[model samples]
Target chain A: MLSHQLMAGLGLSILWINALLIAGAALRELAALRARRARLAGPLLRGRVEQGLGPDRAFATHTVEQVGRAADVRSGIAIHFSDRAYRSTIHGGTLALADGSRHTVPPSDDARSEVWIAPTEADAPPGDAALERAWSEAKQSRGFARSLDRSIREQATIAVALPREEGEATWVFDERFARDWLARREGLAALFIVLELAALAGATAVCFVGGSFESVVTKVGGALCVAWFLGVQPIGVALSEACRPLHRAPVRGAWRRP
Target chain B: MSAGTATHNAESRIFKHPAEMRQFGLVLTYLALLFAMVFVPATRTLPCLALACALSFLNTVVIHNHLHQGMFRSHSLNLAWRCVLSFGALYPASANIPSHNLVHHHFEDEGQPDWAAPERVGFKWHLLNLLHFPNVAGPHTFNGVTRWAALYGREDFRRQYTREMVFAFGLTGALLLVDFWATLFFVLIPQLYGARCILRINLIQHDGCDTTSDYNHSRNFVGRLFNWVMCNNGYHTIHHNRAGLHWSDLAKEHEREVLPRIDPSLDEPSMALYLLRTFVLRFTRPVARAVALAEQRASVPASDLASRAERRQSIEAELRAAP
Candidate 1:
């Protein structure tokens, strides 16, 4: 049997190893965030519209409709729009327009489809300012900052100059962008998992050295930490993202044909 | 959806869901039991350890639910609730927000990127997976929380987290100072077990499933009693689909949105039965054969599953068709 002194030393060593791993993981994530910010440093919204031209170029004020169709519609469309984008859904079936008029329309069938809505009553787009702030803040911040940055980008309405040849180019916000963003975030997550593995290895090594498999605190703590890192953390992350409030900015100035 | 209008309509409401109150009650119950274990001499027996284990399990479940849907609309009240719950959890109340809520949820099981990806190590060796997970993922969870706190200007969150840390560690230190063995068996051991059980449930929920698939991505244990005790966590598909949904509303949502679209194999009537069959009885040829057969049946073509868009359409159609 391992002596108490030896056991204590091993346990302390394990804790120190874990502490180091945590520090290393945090630094790696910070580095990755820095790289990502640098990569996304250009214009908030860039790229010419390829096809799908419409003749209407004037900005019109239209009321949002269909507030109580289904949970999907309510959450996907109604709640997705930022406060600046549309009126409140408290009235259930009727949505108040930017013009103070209410309109009742069919339920939202597609989140991706363009619905006739008024531009937010802002003199200028906040894209550059929001992007600048997010970029600067991301350099110093960690954890959910990446997600917050993504959300900020998602919510910014930037007007892009369209080519004369291209009829209409709606700013490309699609599944591919979402998937790519998720993939990058996942890469950062991988670093954390590696750190966890290191901590576990330390604990396991100490357990073997101590020769006290029956130590309840050691056994249970090690097991709990391992189980939590492996599965529970992911589930929690997934659930939180699902429940996170949608704050999409209104899409304005798609550069339609006159 | 102007910020002012959305805030007025969505944020102004003080009470959103009924489950908040239920969760508060559970927290109170856990606190009472923890105090009893600490103070009452009669409650310090071996049997008390079992009771503590059970309470810790309930505490972790409540904490998990609370993390998803905060117990109170008031941030202060929620913070206080977290502090109180931390004693039972043996970790800070804010422990999961960044790691679990932000990172794990966003990534799911996308192999290496998913911090809690069970598939990182082979799922076939369940023992090894469980044994190694904390060491693997714990640091990430910690780092994620710390980074999030720094990045988001959540100074209050950081303070509370630190406070909870001091409270937990300080109390443990004090207990150890007073009586090491008692603290070990009564408090630390049970808390650890509770933590373990919490993680164990996740493995049971997501192991051996397509993380990307909408309906079949997660395996659900439909055991009524199990769900009732655990805040309906067994309905994982519904939980994943609508993460922000209150625990009380999961079953109804599952019936309406998930039931028709999800594969039947995804739902297991009893978690106990599944555990026994998969983990305990796998050595027996019959049980192994049955497990293999079930896995095969559950493996439906990806195309056969309805896209999220299709599901949304169906839900909209159902709602429109409804009176």
Candidate 2:
């Protein structure tokens, strides 16, 4: 019964480790994709902005118009900001709806911001209320966009925002900073592997020297393996006051001093 | 400013490569012995298995040393050592390496905990976890027959189901075909007691140690003879301080720095006795505050444990310094 139990546990440990290995593989894959996307798209966007096709203009001509046509909406513009230091992005453009009202609005700087166009009835009051609303909406959108843009440029912050509901925007902080901010995020799983092996080695020593069985259980039960990776492991990496760059960007030069 | 930078640079020489030949040989020999324990079968496979189990546990501790290569920076050798140690069947090397080297080393016990606590964990709730099934909130019951039957239900468990089933069946089948009493006494009962003992010792190590002093929280049973047999792991404080450092160098560095600092009076009691006493004392008066206060007095390496300086500062600041 006892050997059976221990054997059963050993088997379980194998499976658990394999699952963790897969999860680590996935994280590495995602990080690679993100890095690749950044590498490929970064230069092209920078080129366009430098050519005086300001992000807003370039997006209006290239990106947003295509999106508008694909979605069966009116014209749209994507405002691109050149500063990588700044994290905010703003989009401003006009939207034509099924209704005849041409809502010329500056949408928020956020990538997901949207401007909704509603039809004005022929029997509507002939005041400039529709135009005023459009202007007001544009003003609000621009303000938020500019603020986000400023925030991104000023700090090493990660965020995503999109317009949602009426007059409200949804913002998401990049909590996946652990994966992005650290150089060894992908290597975390590999580190865990080494730790487990060392722990097993240590347990054997304890057992050989003192006949300690608890060392075996603690080493093999997979709890310490779980705890180190989930709790202590990530904490050590995150809390360390070191910013290890994943790649050498000689072209980028030293980051501008704070 | 550039001169200041140069001066700072002079003080620290960053390594493009790191390696250690002596540590590598030690680790290689240790692993060879571990393999022998598993396959030699001198006393019987059961004793051999127990020996393997114990070695595998110790291997986990050594894994910490291997990652840092702090004591032995022979980059090529450590890399090879890492590869071999990680590939062991007893414990998957890849899983622990990344989790410990990258995640646990980075996270410790707080922040993003990918390795420590379970998604859900508790003794009362853990019976479900044993079968690899996480319990949702509901009334659940188990009787002797049902519990026994549940063991055979492999579908519910994603990872260990097939592996455990095969091992159990294979062991039982081999035993029934051979000497039943021998299997019962050697394989069944002794192994069970061994596992139970392992858990008790593990729990006692950190159970009532001063949380404030991270070093004290995880007590070290130090002795050259004992440590040498266990890959120099009795130097818990030094190991935690320089995790990537190898086991052999851990003792040397610990003696050079930590030993001279600790009051010799503290040498009278064995770590085992101290931990045991703390465990008993915890039952009557929880050691949390005292431990925390003690931690304020000094530095202890285990991040979960506290330091004496911090403990003492906090106490003096609170109790005496306030004029």
Candidate 3:
């Protein structure tokens, strides 16, 4: 036979568990957001590379050629850069450059190549522009690039030349970014873990006290409210994370400028 | 960007994908059914338990589609929707991310790595495989998720997964507080059945199929009505090929790319008929044998498959040439 006391105890235990779970999720999100903000604030290259013409076409062409060469040996390389898309087959590789050059690279393992574009060239303002104007343009470009298609946003890697002689940085828009971002925020993450654990303890104590109350409705209502508040936020984070791309593009070149 | 356009955009933004609107409708229907089961006196009978089980199974399918292509633009709203959906379905979206999206998609039909690998059981005993799959696969799925979280240092995923576990168990406990028998009948039994059904569908999808071939790796059920109810999931080959394609676009992709390249045996007209043939009737017919045999025959080197006359001539020449 089930007793009312037993039921109340079970409800209280659940309420405490739900609260702990929610608190942990909230803390993780807080840490993730902080890390993301820090990453964005730092001087990192972020923008879509427009198709270069005439003399300004070296980087895109070189990258496409290298990508084509790599795709010959390997399968599943679908790259969309500038104005054209290039899908590689085992038989041959087709590279469509932004400068309206379409060429095929023969399939060979020996043909593997890499192309590295200097951050200064990729991000530098064309012609003669004031430093302020270049900086403003760079900022706008970053914002615009964020709104690009998910495939481009996820697959593209930006070359960044850090200020104050900190040297060049490679910013990839994939899972590695998350790992690297989180690695830099170890202190905040530790604090969040401790706070979550404390919240769990506090919730357990509150639930235990509430279970002893005379009114069953009051106990049940309080548990439901706690569950609702705790459950909703973390579940949202999980959904967002699920929608994230699972695949990362193969990185070829990493040559950085001095 | 006009006032009318802005309003329309805002309204449209409620669901990110067109398929999400259908998902939203399914979720609403599940909620209605759940409320009826819980609150309506007429629905409190034993048969209502069966109804709950069916509804829960549908919820799992809906959640599976949501896990692949999220319902909303905002991450928070999608997560919230997942949590609400989980209450009905009893399968956590957090677990689904690592298990279904990452591991299963990555290492599909690859035996140990693929938690839902139908080939784990002996070829002669597919029914046993279907019956025992959830038991064998459930641990692997959870273990895979844990291993992935640890390997990638995905603390956020770990925390969210923990939260889902807590929420599921806590909600069950809370429900038990109201009525023990009702919770047992409606929630626990339905949850168990839903979980089994989820695993069963995966087994049915990939069972006895070639995992190596690009086009014919998975069997596709082409029933229009089933695809509609299952969010075009019947177009399995296309889904596997273009995992990122929206569920609404799967039929079009299937027709365009997969239909020509894929072997005829790989495409089934109805899942119900396939299941009946494969499991219920225990049909011994081999649909993929001809394709598999052809693939095997093609894989052999031309030198190995040379005619007897050529082999004899080569042997005689070799013997004469030998000192």
Candidate 4:
């Protein structure tokens, strides 16, 4: 029946769509974990730089990490610290502090990565809906490009230039935003776990269930399960990227001498 | 006239390039095979259905190319061909104009997001990105198409789009009425699969690429067989840089212009290797794309049918200008 076919497609779409959303949520969680990882850190225990900087170790270490994110540290991201905050430019062992003084930093990758937030005047992207009318009305009142250019150009101050996106990866703010962010993220983490469980359970059942399932359904479901398993292999890469190596952590790095 | 010259002349009259015959043939094969399954139930095997699904996916690609640069020289034939392509993919082919050609080609240029940007999914696993990308992208494309048509679309554009859409769905409806089982298995599955694959192409080609750079904006799959089967879509960096270039000329254009200027990492020897590395073995992670926060930040790309020589000169200028 057409109804049966449509129903099957609908069922498949609903299942797959939820699966995708869950995967997206996991990505966001890792981003949040990373952001949390970037916050204030303890002074390096007894490293050369830690010993050299003495009491200024923690502040310098934290600032350096944040500054790296703002510059060309990552493949594509460049999230410079806000104007008020101190930033640095790393040149191998030497660090050029934002304040103009330079310091020699260690070779280890142990600094915390600051989250990138859009500036005050940054307007969120236009919603994807009924664009024709919105465009027409806007065009009637003022040229679309001209209006947008005027609006953004009119801003009194711009903090970040072109940055990446929102959510865990970039959405910037201070520790005050951290509590609410944590609360919301805790719910998301819970959701992520639940979704993972459900996906595993569903895929397992779909793959292993016997003759009760229509043979065609069994074949299609099994294919989806296998394919999905293949898809998640990058989870390893994502995990490797997100999880800081315990051995190389700032505290551990700081404790050791070069 | 000699038979060879007569045939060549006739072919030229029908198609802008003789190569489009292959695309037209594949579209026919998909439709013919679907009907064969419907009428000749014995022919409806798993392999046959799978072939249908493959052809159906190819149909979407063919339609995408057709939408970009019409294969037929005759305007009427081009419009009629869209109906055939639409029926094969089970959606109006014109939708690609707004969703892919306008929005995607611009690639979040002018502060608008590519509706199908991989960041939309940002799946933990690479494979999941491909699998689930279509679910998000499909709706966005259609919605964008509808909204675009309502605002900027012309009378002919709206009429033609409506006609193509009605032909696709109307024919599918008629098929369902004739034999629901055949329509479901033989037609719908393949159509849906094709639609999904086409949607995945954006993420596959552009994901993790430096959309900001002059040369690194897209990943290119350079496998000869892959390009042959996919009508040279594997050379995506060149395609985006030169949207109006014919599919047949893409390989040569990519070699001469894109291969030199583009980051070597953007070029892949095999799409199969890419799919395995990206979606299966999961070697690469999504490169966090850096786009401007403020609206209207993007510089406009060149006008349509941009010369490859012009792009090369631009790349050279940027390189020379770079500190």
Model 1, TM vs. native: 0.50
- In the range A1-258, model 4's lDDT, one tens digit per residue, is 233334345445545564655455565666656555443232211112112232322222222121111121223222211111222211123333334555443322223223222223533334444333333433331223212111111111111111133431111123334444455545555555565657655874664456443455655554565355434433422332233222111210010001
Off by over 4 Å in 1: A1-134, A137-258, B1-18, B108-112, B283-323
Q: Looking at model 4, how many pairs of residues clash?
A: 5
Top of the candidates by TM-score: 4
- Predicted candidate 1 versus true structure: per-residue lDDT over B1-323, tens digit per residue: 79877655554364456555556666677666656665665666556667778878888888877777666677676677777778777888677665555455544311124556554333244554544455445444564455345422355567788888888778766865565535554677667668767766666666666665556667788878888877898888887667667888898887776666566767889988887776666642221112223324544343344554444444334323420
Interface RMSD of 2: 20.0
Which tens-of-lDDT digit does each residue in A177-236 have in candidate 1?
Answer: 533553555555565556555665655564454466456655555544444434544543
- Could you tell me the TM-score of chain A in candidate 4? 0.31
Q: Give the docking tier of candidate 2.
A: incorrect
- lDDT, candidate 4, at B149: 60
* The 10-residue segment with the lowest total lDDT in model 3 chain A: A141-150
True contacts kept of each: 0.02, 0.00, 0.00, 0.02
Provide the lDDT at B43 for model 3. Answer: 69
* Residue A245 lDDT (model 2): 26
At residue B23, give the lDDT of candidate 1.
61
Every candidate's DockQ is 0.02, 0.01, 0.01, 0.04
Which is the better candidate, 1 or 3, if ranked by DockQ?
1
lDDT of 4 by residue, B142-210 (tens): 655654564321346678889998999899879866875466667877887898798888888888776
lDDT of 3 by residue, A90-197 (tens): 122333433455533333221232122221222322233343343233222111111111112212333322232343222333234554544544444455456555
- Give each model a TM-score: 0.50, 0.33, 0.49, 0.59
Which model scores highest in lDDT?
4
Task: Report the lDDT tens digits of candidate 2 across residue range B1-323.
Answer: 69977754543343222223333444454445443433333434555556645554444445555444433334444344444544322222323333434333332221222233232112222222222211110001111112212221112221332343344445544653454333433343333333223223333333334433433434456766667655765665555445545566776876665454343322223555665455343444223334444434546543432343343334223322211
